[model samples]
Target: MTFSIVGRSDDGKAVGVAVASKFLGVGAAVPAALADVGAVATQSYANLAYRPQALALLGTGVSASAALAGLIAADDGPVSHRQAGIVGMTGPGATFTGADCHDWAGGAAGDGYAAQGNMLAGPSVIAGMEQTWLGSSGALPYRLLAALRAGDQAGGDRRGRQSAALLVVSPGRGYGGTSDVWVDLRVDDHVDPVAELGRLLTMHSLYFESPEPSSLIALTGPVAEEVRALLAAAGFGGEELEEELASWAGVENLEMRVVKGSIDPLVLTHLRAAG
Candidate 1:
């Protein structure tokens, strides 16, 4: 019914999951993670309780294999119908596919990552995902998304696609640096849920991702005048152009891409478009 990748960044700074399924709202039930703890994806008659319980176990210093074992041991449900993948921040990963799972169901685990799929087109679904995760570069979220997209290309859930999700966690990565809930976008229902999730992820990056200092351009000369005009048109301009621009960017939820003394190229383009 679903396919997913659970992983910790190679740099060990983040943990996340990317998943897609024929089932509606698979995101709500299949993925879970905690920064510096671990990530898990439970499907094939997913045990929702396995979410928090597995994270708790990982938080308590349990290995991925041990944590998954604990979850299965305590479960009284139809064990043979369950499928799961676990990856902890500091240990080898693990995966499971109950014998009773639908045909074409199984999984694989490797250093810092695990991938699993049940009722997939074939074993290539998980294999393509694993290959992508290993060879991909860039941020953790993109790598996870690439893995999911690779799975989809390999023929994802056997039935069809309905929903997809990406969950990432890192201390202080959330909005305003107030939480660990970084990158929690979901496409509950879409004809092409994976593609939709990718678009949402891009929007998330634009709105929430921080720009490098080197990427910022000081607002000066003609650029300053341009910014001033944009701010004035937006009814946020005042005697202090720099302060007004920052405030306006904040109001538009574009502050993360703008600096106090400089304008990010992306932010400048946004301001131009908005004005």
Candidate 2:
């Protein structure tokens, strides 16, 4: 009924999980992570408590294997119905599929990733996820999303899909530099939840990603005049156009691309499109 991948970025600076299921609000129950700690995905009769407990154990410097052992030891319910995947920030990863899990259920783990599924089309589902995670390059969130897409294409949940989620954490990566929740998006119920999740991820990247230094354009000459005209047309009248632009960016949720003294080329393009 569920398929998931938990992983740490190759650089070991990010951790995340991607999951899809024929279950309602799987996002609320499946994935958890803390930057610099570890990531966990609990499914197939998932014990929600495993999430926080696993993070706490990893934060205490335990390896992924040891944390999983602790979870098994503390479980009062039947462990044979449960499935989980884990990946620590700086250690090997692990996955477990219980004896009582639905048919076509199993998991695989490698240096920094764990892919698991239950009630899946076949073992190829988890295999496709693992292959994508290993071969794909870029941000952890993107890679995790790609892995889920690959698994779905390879034949995802045997029962079909309803909900999907993506969560990635990195220190100081959250909005306004407040937390580690770099990307947290979900499709609680959708006919094509994985595809919807991908669309959301792309929007999130554009709205939150910082501009590359080379992509910054100085607000001088024609560019500066064009910006002034846009802001003025938008009813902005502040003496400092930079401040006005910042305010506009905030309203449009583009503050992450805002620079104090220069405009991002992407931002300029966006403004032009709207104008």
Candidate 3:
């Protein structure tokens, strides 16, 4: 009923999970992560307690393998029906597919990543996810999303897709640098949840991520004049261009991309499109 990957960044500063399933709201059930700790995905009659319990073990310095083993040992419910993947900040990942899980159920694990699924089309789904995750580059969220998409393309859950989710975490990576949750997007129900999840991730990047320093354009000369005109057209004109622009960006939920003396090209593009 589900396919998922649990992973951490090369530097061990980020960890996350991406999952899709025929089940409703798989995100809320399968994925859990903590910056500098680890990540977990529990499904196939998922015992929700496994999420927090595994994190607690990781917080206490347990390896992914040990944490998962302990959870299975302690579980009071039918352990034979559960599936999970765990990845720690500094060691190899671990995965488990209970004996009673539906056909085509299995998992793979290695340094920094794990892939697993049950009720899948075939082993190719997990293979495709692992290949993409190992070969991909860039931010952790994009890599995770790419791997999830790979699984979807490789004949994902035989039961078909109903929902999908992406979650990533890192120290001080959340909004205003106040939380560890860098990305958390979900599609609880959709005809094409994986693609929809990708779309939401793109919007999340624009609204929440800061621009690269090299992508910033100084707000002076023609750029400044153009911005002023655009702001005025948007009914945001003011003597203080920065202040008015900040206000406009706040309204547009692009405040995180706003810089005092410069504008991100993406933000500028949005301004022009709005005008």
Give the alpha-carbon lDDT of every model.
Answer: 0.92, 0.93, 0.95
Query: Cα RMSD for candidate 1?
Result: 1.1
How do the residues 1-275 of candidate 1 rate in per-residue lDDT, one tens digit apiece? 89999988888889999999998898999999998898999999999999999999999998999999999999999999999999998877999999999989999998999999999999999999999999987799999999999999999999999999999999899998999988999999899999999999999999999888988888889989998988899898699988898888888898777677788898888888988
**Residue-wise lDDT of candidate 3 within 1-275, one digit each (tens)?**
89999999987899999999998888989999988899999999999999999999999998999999999999999999999999999899999999999989999999999999999999999999999999987899999999999999999999898999999999999999999999999999998999999999999999999899999999999999999999999999899999999999999999999987999999999999999
Global CA lDDT of candidate 3, please?
Answer: 0.95
Candidate 1 has what TM-score? 0.97
- TM-scores of all predicted structures: 0.97, 0.96, 0.99
Judged by whole-model lDDT over C-alpha atoms, candidate 1 comes out at 0.92
Q: Which ranges of candidate 1 are over 4 A from the true structure?
A: none
What shift in Å separates residue 50 of candidate 2 from its native position after superposition? 0.7
Maximum-lDDT candidate:
3
Worst 10 residues of 2 by lDDT: 230-239
Error of 1 at 170 (Å): 0.3
Segments in model 2 whose C-alpha atoms lie over 4 Å from true places: none
| Clash count, candidate 1 | 0
